[model samples]
Target: MRLTVLGCSGSVTGPDSPASGYLVTAPDAPPLVVDFGGGVLGALQRHANPNDVTVLLSHLHADHCLDVPGLLVWRRYGPEPAAERALLYGPEDAALRLGTASAEVGGECDDVSDTLEVRGWVDREPVKFGELSVTPFKVFHPPQSYGLRVVDSAGAVLAYSGDTGACSAVEELAQGADVFLCEASWTHDPGNRPVGVHLSGTEAGEVARRAGVGQLLLTHIPPWTSREDVLAEARAAFDGPVRAVNASESFDVVKSGSAVRRQTS
Candidate 1:
């Protein structure tokens, strides 16, 4: 399976990168986009057709899914409009929230049912897309959130920690994954940071170490956070390779310690 980093900035759009978004694709399986945050729709055009891919949102935070409305626009009026409604899998409130965002009038949610086939993600239930099986694990985040575990036909696993804090469920979702796409939104500061909302770099590393994942690909680092410090924290905890992913970077998921070979596109 191929994984692409559409954007990796945390919380908000940074000067260099947009907010959170990712692309995962494999042969025979339809292209899957993990999130459609700010600036992602434009970025996706470079790699895949927005009208053809299935969208899986980890949460409804603006940085993680605000651009989904843009997708609705493209699918409804683009030069070549999609033949069918776009498939979207997210939280139970996804349709209501996204529909609200797409609303044209005041206080009235747009009937997005026509433009998108909104579906809710059930915890631990595997959703199949030809060669790939995606499972969502409940996470310790606001209203509702989940980490996605994707396994290919060949057993290559790509586990995305979505936007989560330290929790056993996160580790379970990442257990034995070939690539652990975790979020380290902050440097290690337990005393000041809020609890059960986001993870520090040290915590991310701890999760990777505890899960025994093959490779640690850190993401969701905010612009204000120190990347080098986060990297140092993760490397100190995880003996395996740990990389802070950047926008446009791509990886080939493999079942080895040295898995996820990076390529700049």
Candidate 2:
């Protein structure tokens, strides 16, 4: 299994990266996309055909899923139109939310089912996508949100904490994962910021420590936050391999429960 970081900018698109998006692929299977955020469509084109990808979203936040309309356009009108309808899995009302966001001037939601088959993910229920199986776990985020535990056919697991605060669900989802792609969207100082919305780098480290993950890849960092500061805070708490995500980098997943990082720049 392979994991690619298409973009990892936190709440908004940064000058160098898009908001939040990832690509998970395995041999002989269609790639799975997680959180098609702003600017991701262009980035995704560099890696794989949008038509052949399955999409999974964590929530309805604009920064996390704003590129669905662009993907729809590509799959429907690109040079080689989609030969098969792609699958999109997300929270309840996903179709309506994404449809509304991709609506035209008339304010009428585009028929996403025209090119993508949408489904709502139920907590802890495994959804099989090719050789990968994904189980969503409810996390602590406003409105509705989930963290994913993805297991390849070979038993390698990759967990993602999609824009969550310090929550038990995150730790449970990340347990024994080969790669923990967690969000670090706030400062370590809780008194200086809001609570129960996003995790600090230190908090991310704590979760990684508790979950005993093999590698911790910190993502969803805002442009205003210093990556060095976040790394330092995370490292202070977790005595394991912890790295910040760079756009377009890939990680090879091993069945032995390790993720080998590969730079794609």
Give the best candidate by TM-score: 1
For model 2, the superposed segments whose C-alpha errors exceed 4 Å read 263-265
Question: Least accurate stretch of 10 residues (summed lDDT) in model 2?
Answer: 256-265
- Please provide, for model 2 over 51-104, each residue's C-alpha lDDT reduced to its tens digit, 9 standing for 90 to 100: 888999999899989999999889888999988888999989999888887788
How many clashes in candidate 2? 0
Clash list (residue pairs), candidate 1:
none
Residue range 1-265, candidate 1, lDDT tens digits: 9999999999998898879999999998999999989989988999999989999999999999999999999999999999998789999999999989999997999889888999999999999998999999999998699999999998999999999989999999999999999999998987889998999999999999999999999999999999999999999999998999999999999877677888777
